[model samples]
Target chain A: MTEQPTEGEPIRTGIVGLGKMGISHFAIVNAHPDLELVAVADTNSFLTSAIKRYTKVEVYKDFKRMINEAKLDAVLIATPTRFHFEVARYALERGINVFVEKPFTLTLEEGRALVDLAKQKGVVNQVGFHNHFVGTFAEVRRLVNAQAIGEVYHVTGEAYGQVVTKPKTSTWRSKKSEGGGCLHDYASHVVDLMNWVVGPPVKVLGAHLNSIFSEGVDDAVHAVFEYKNGMSGQLTTNWSDTTYRKMTTRISINGKKGKIIADRQEVRVFLMPGCEVDGYGEGWSIKYITDLQKPVWFYMRGEEYSTQIDTFAHNIKSRNTEGENTFASAYATDEVLDMIQKADRARS
Target chain B: MDRILFGDNQFFGVNHMSEEKARAQSMKFKDTAAIMKVIDVAYSEGIKTFMCTTHDRIGEVTDIVRDNPDRYNNFTFYPGMPYAHKYANAVGELGIMGTLKKFAPGSIISTVIRGAMAGITQDAYELMKMLVDAEMQRFQGTRTPVVFLQNVVTDLLLGFNMREMFRAFHDYVQQKYEAEAGFFSMNMPMLVDVLHGEGIENPIVCSNINKIGFRMCGGIEKYIDTLKTKQFRPIAMSVYASGAIPPEEAIKWVCELPKLEAIVFGASSRRNIVGTRDLVEKYWRFDN
Candidate 1:
């Protein structure tokens, strides 16, 4: 795009693992004048052979060989979970910037260790929690802090979609050995969101149920967290449901100024004039604290995602310039995700 | 002193007192209930908030608050739904693509390595670090005030490092809101007591995470004991789970309620309403 990778020019980039996400990354990389998809790697021989025939740049069976031979300035890891550590570590150890996918690690220790390694090697390393870049949550967070809804006393969230039915026979997901469960794959995002909205989960209580497509791994999960500020939240995620395929990500915060519900992408505020409920029967009357008029939909999508990416890039660049490419920012909220999975596993 | 929140009166159990006692110490003694009993008490006492569950005992608070518009005005309930159980995310991801990439028959399986780099450490940690970083970013300068709920899982199913587990949650939250004084789980009230007594000194937010069903259980005195060891900003909760008690008794216990900083409890019946009023009035002892 920019004629060629030039000295002091924006770094040319390539992506590995051309699944849907990988392919998207590829096109995006190529679009950047300063960046180019110099090479692409996929283990599938047939896929690699086909890609080689279609693309101008070289294609390889392995990312490591591609990185070494192609001399890439940066690599976008679109690879699966287990392979991340190896690929990321290799790239960092070599001085190549790396962008790896989410979950970072299946275990906290592993995740922590990678962070440490990133620090030691001083390479540009980042894990994608892409949603954080979106601006809506930040606005909702702003209102909550301003006591916009009053005092966020309690919070609840529901994330629903197709439920995961563990296949009868056997898949990696069926066994609880890998990161195949719904909690890790899906709820981790919710958990991360919880950390972002409130704080860290002081405690996490979970119920992992695997019914429909059951080999072993759970399909749906429900979790509750108690915040340190005396606030609390609940998050529910499902990967298997035959019904309407909808993803409802709503956070209802009962605050003081009003009742706030952050539904899907935007935040809504309701004025709660704590009044009396009408009479139900006899002398006893119920409270009429329902249907507080409020903001319905106010979405801010692009900014948050961009901010998230920029922050990672900035951290990486700062680290690189300083010869300490380790993430200089605060600890990521993901440390507890695997624990949620582990805890969910023991919910019986 | 940590912030204290009064749970619904019945949480301490109403069945313990009598109907006669209920009549004697009811709100008719002068229902000073203003701005919702809980919010009034919280505002008056300078307390923040408290947690509540929609359990059987929860009925008591709903009953009283249901009727009175004045006394139980801004009563906020901290619903304890989907209580903390435990969980884990084991087996890291296999490589992303190529023959080395392990694909599950369904979701995620095996640690597929092509030839040499098998079982290598992954970027999972980096993901967590970034997440923690981002969380802190959210609460860096929050005005509404936030705290961390320090948690411990007795039945941990994740990789061992219990301390690391605690640290992860702590650091994660610390990145955002100012870390609260302390954390509480139903089972670990004693642990909280120890952590507090040991001088960890952050105010403790009450949670029955450790206690399981705080209603059907005992050992609440773990809280009382902790209270004794060191004065806690007891966000007192779990009073309703005391069982199908009468309003009078619930009110009376609430009247006593360890008197930390704040208490937010609901009255179950007319008697409970009256008792709540009487409890506030009598305890503050004729205070204007």
Candidate 2:
């Protein structure tokens, strides 16, 4: 479609980490009004087409070019998992805002650097863990707030089918040295979800195994966590299974009355733990979705590249953005993953 | 003397990323080097007949600015650019690293006509108009009329389905542009010579798949019909196509033709030149 300006307008944006994701992100900038995909600086030739197609935009096969020529309002980073820190730091140093893809920064320490930089620059920033807004998750939030499932007891999150089918050859996706593999690639979502519902984890003890995409990155992982509220949970993510494979987590809680299972589509609860569930002991009954979030569920892949880039376009009109996708959400997610990696999976 | 000349047909091998690589590799310089290498070598060999001008425009636009000349230096410069004087003079005068400041923009136009592709947008047309004006105003009307050593100029005038395989005309130009430009620039060449019965500079030319229906035109002689159709003329040249005809046999037949000037032969290595030169001396059927 044609998005024309009233003339003499500048839509400044910066993109980092030139990869497939970054290229697609450039498409996001391309199709947005009030958005000029100004400078694309990646360590590789990832955004060459992006730069040319959006003519008059500056490009850097290196980060320094983004810093130098493009006076950007915001920067989106999709770099090597490790390079995320340095590139984000550089953009922040330039006072450019940021939109980073997940695994926010490499380490918590690096994450802190970005947080500090964002604060110091006084610019708005967000991370792309856009899936939180899709599917029954939004409904999951509504149901919980409405107390549709009662008290939170035990949350079981399962993420599968990440590494069971290997991509041909190797990409940045297959390296632990670069935050590669499934635990970081897919389970980073689960960590975000856990935080979204349970606030934060008090302690996380996890064990991981590598089944495929064996560049020493974890593809299979099991984790159990204790929240500060004396509540506990068990969650597992596997990249080695397919067929019935997908991203699904059943968060069931037994409050004073019954229990509920909130997945991507619908939230189901046995009102008395006796009627619907086959193995429910006594007070089990089926309670249909009392409330559902109004978004069209984006199954399989996030709806047309997820996060319905429209909100982001409208976000351009606002001064602040808040959600599971806010920079706070990203930093929080990174903190959890880094903690889990260090405590549960980092060991050789 | 039969006015014949040599032209490389498979010059810059077309370089659009095949669908196979869509998933495996991101299109990048390292990936596109195969086509780039050929262009670099094509110029070093002094075979100036170029069918794609956008490729040359790219070299002159961005590469040299970054202190990257080794890549663009292998070929003689011939491109059909929009504005040669402004682009060349600006890039050349900018004296910035990674920019194309040294190449002569005027020489660009004399290399190709309307790129290897056609369909000029208003912006492109404007770019051409400004190019001619800027070239004349800046260099004092000293701009060289540029045209790529192209295929049937007359067939293009005749409309669709006239030239076999020429349907890929736009694509051929894009291939040259990508290969020569190191694969990023997209601007196409402008056709400024059709109705005026005009010719591009450096009359060296080549005929590719569009060689049928034109009489006495042996193996690939059909393209000559377009030139005849355009009320056009060319310095006749024979090229090495398909199997081995030996350089001597190829040159002899061209020399026997009414206006054949020189027959171009491709070489894989330095040793191949010896056989080509031997054939030229022993069997060249020149008027001399």
Candidate 3:
């Protein structure tokens, strides 16, 4: 087991990868009161050198050497998807807490192995499925759990963005094996949101992956899901939609007594005449993200990012193994992604 | 600062309330001239200050104002620094070294050498000064009475508990640019307290101060308390909560707040601009 820090002592932390998300996480981690960012590792010399020049933290070109030398109590992994399993496993084996970015692993087997290893080590582990911390989305889950929308019959999850409008050079995102496509980068968020608000689909009834702008990778994903209790849902995600200025994820739930439509900004609820939910009235009620959100200590991009990091820090401090966005929970999402891919391949 | 400062969100397709509206505005203002037309309208309506992000396109707008001194004689620009997406896009296209070489203010050799020294000394303030100079490059030949640190960087520094950077920015802008340094943040209460602790009296801090408390961190009550008790010049943005509140109610409520130094709003058309300006005028009087 890892040595726990004394109460009030900061958690010694190390981070691997210096991509866009990595840099954002680095900022947040460096600022967190509970985390003392000790070291950072990145393969890109320019990024590492720039970070070294700016911050007092140690920088290394090799993550393994950094992890070995930094004496870190925890590690945040934001590397490309294919590297997740190996990096996470290496940390977990050392009894170090791990926080891996979303699309937890490239394959289901890898995700399962990491989840099992994390459990065996009894470490505080989390996946960066940030939407679970969004106020509007969290409210949706609460209302659904409260059965505010009684006897849920159907749900629809959608995400669209203008990630790639023109033909671009190949980055890690354009490579399917490197987790560059919409199915992994964009659709994973929608799928995880759906899983969090509603339940994960037990069966993938039908699925199709389309490539609108990139080669060898899917830019759009359409899938139909079936729950064990006979509820059904659909997911539609397109990263090539130029109409959107940025990524927008929305989930609509229709039930016998009411309906709920939620996005990153707000959540709208409709209840029948007799249906009742606290703080919400019948017919229609709108709740904005501003009213629902709690004040984060540090907010960049969104409160959810900081919230997730804070939660992870708290879990590590309290040694709470099972928490929001755990390794097991992310592994379940990976299973659904696998099923969707298999269904799409069988049809094609 | 102007009491009713104009904002640049509408011209840049940044409607937080509605994506459809944002997309429509993006389409409508694809040309720089279209944006200039709206600015002309706001100017005609007596809103003389343009509080804008340092987007690349804004460089063109500044150029227009710089050239036609007769048209924009009394106009002022409150430029917020580090339009973060610009840097992100630059890093994506150009490697980190290339991005620094391209955007750093001084000669390339000096930039790299100073960058290394700043790293060795762990001098974040020196690096921050360089970035401030880089972002302020486009505002040359214009009347920038107040320069703002964007919410992204301000809030990040607030989280990092780096109060020295805030002071550095405040002092640097005053000494270097002859301008008062403004800060845009999501958490006004915390920022005000930090600045107050740093002995920066009556600092200029802009945040989302609206009737509905939209995007106002620390809740509406804490914000009210800060306004009532703190000694900071408050500039209210997102006054309508991205159209969630009607112009009449939003202006009425915000104008009633204690010591609200300014209100920054954005609109695309003459009608909306005139409408908001009239409402602000009805509630709050501008002596100047």
Q: Which candidate has the top score in TM-score?
A: 3
On the 0 to 100 scale, the lDDT of residue B24 in model 1 is: 43
Model 1 lDDT per residue over A32-66, tens place: 33455678888755345434543565788888888
Evaluated on chain A only, model 1 obtains a TM-score of: 0.76
Per-residue lDDT over B29-147 for candidate 2, one digit per residue giving the tens place of the 0 to 100 score: 22335334544444444443332334333443224322454544322333333322233223212321112212324433222232322222322333333332332232221212223
For each candidate, what's the DockQ? 0.01, 0.01, 0.30
Query: What range of 10 consecutive residues in model 1 chain A has the weakest lDDT sum?
Result: A292-301
True-vs-predicted CA distance for residue B84, candidate 1, Å: 38
Provide the TM-score, chain A, model 2: 0.80
Tens-digit lDDT string for candidate 1 (B57-100): 33444455546546545543443321221111111222124211
Q: Give all candidates' CA lDDT scores.
A: 0.47, 0.47, 0.86
Interface RMSD of 2: 23.3
Screening candidate 3 with a backbone cut-off below 3 angstroms (N, C-alpha, C), the clashing residue pairs are A173-A180
Shift of residue A292 alpha carbon in model 1, Å: 23
